[model samples]
Target: MRLETEMNMLQAKIQAGIVKDETVGNTSRFSDANPNLPHFQDDLDIWLTRSERFAESKNWSRDKWSSSLSALLTGRALDCYGRLSSEQAQDYDKVKQALMKRYD
Candidate 1:
């Protein structure tokens, strides 16, 4: 019984750690402003690459990635969201790929 209680306590600690990470990760890290419009594509691309590297399971859910990306975009960069097709908007991977294709 003591062993089981210890295991449960360990599991709670591990779960709590994951939640803390997810909370921190949800914040926007990319910047939307760059004087050179073309160069901004490189910035966005690099951000995406880094995001993938840090993503849980090395794979970010479509909604999670898209939400993060949207939070960071500004100006013309933000306008790209309007271009999403109905089908693409519904899928996170499709939204990510479409935005990358258009912006990066």
Candidate 2:
């Protein structure tokens, strides 16, 4: 009975995205600095919204929506980085690298 209980608990944790061997230490640093980091669904929503807005405003065909959204997001990212202070941007890059390494 005790063994069965432990197995059920382990399965529940794995289903909840908490794999025991996934990380050596806390993985909160990535989420801490960039609280708005895009998850899978968030990315999809961002692209969809951008495409919808572009098509509505410019009367663009559905086929052009993807290209328009890609350009807009790229421009927006560049603009945001351009507005950041050099030191702050560098620090952001370092944090980003650390986060990537954590996943790797």
Candidate 3:
């Protein structure tokens, strides 16, 4: 009876260890397979098509096309930044003037 009980306990420990090892192995494999998954962009296809069209329209010179696209993207970013800054400045001035008037 004592020997049987010890054997049963040993078997249970081996089974539990196997289960824990399998779980850890599976989680590591899953994370490795999906590392750095990209965020899905709603207009990804449209953006790709536009980029291709732009490249083709310029006769597909790799350097020139890439440079042109880079410049265009930079200009757009700057324009957006300028607009945001101007709006923020106007709001700040308005608030400041309003506060001055209130105090006066």
Candidate 4:
């Protein structure tokens, strides 16, 4: 059948490296929307706003926000995150408050 032949040709192309078969599971929907937290900027307020928006857009839980923000933090912001107690670090509001206090 024509469909079977086309499928075989597609498989052959993939095997030969002529085509890249990127399936849904292997491709990230957010690849193009990669968000980077602003680092060491005077505009901490703006950075926090953008981070919140990014988390919301991704449908990430509030519980996940602190760790995610910590991972993207750099320079003094990273230091601020590091100085938090383990329990405080787990709370996004605590992390945000710490960062604000550090920068303020």
The global C-alpha lDDT for each of the candidates, from Candidate 1 onward, is: 0.45, 0.36, 0.33, 0.63
Model 1 spans > 4 angstroms off: 1-42, 57-62, 85-87
In candidate 3 the C-alpha lDDT for residue 19 amounts to: 25
- Candidate 1 lDDT by residue in tens digits, 1-104: 44543443333233223222466565222232111112124466676565545454435454454444443444454455445543454455775676677765
Q: List the residue pairs that clash in candidate 2.
A: none
Model 4 clashing residue pairs (backbone)? none
By lDDT rank, best first, the candidates go 4, 1, 2, 3
Q: Pick out the ten consecutive residues of candidate 3 with the lowest summed lDDT.
A: 28-37
Tens-digit lDDT track for model 4 on 16-100? 2233436643523233133454443667888899889988987876876775565556667766766666678778999899999
lDDT of 2 by residue, 1-84 (tens): 445434433432332234444566543322112112222222434544544554566664444332222222223343332333
Order of models, best TM-score first: 4, 1, 3, 2
- Model 1 whole-model lDDT (C-alpha atoms): 0.45
Instruction: Please give each candidate's TM-score.
Output: 0.42, 0.24, 0.25, 0.61
Error in Å for residue 64 of model 3: 1.3
TM-score of 1: 0.42
lDDT value, residue 72 of candidate 1: 41
Question: What digit string (tens of lDDT, one per residue) describes model 3 on residues 1-104?
Answer: 44543443333233222223465564222211121222223343454356556556546444333223222222222232223322332242332233234334
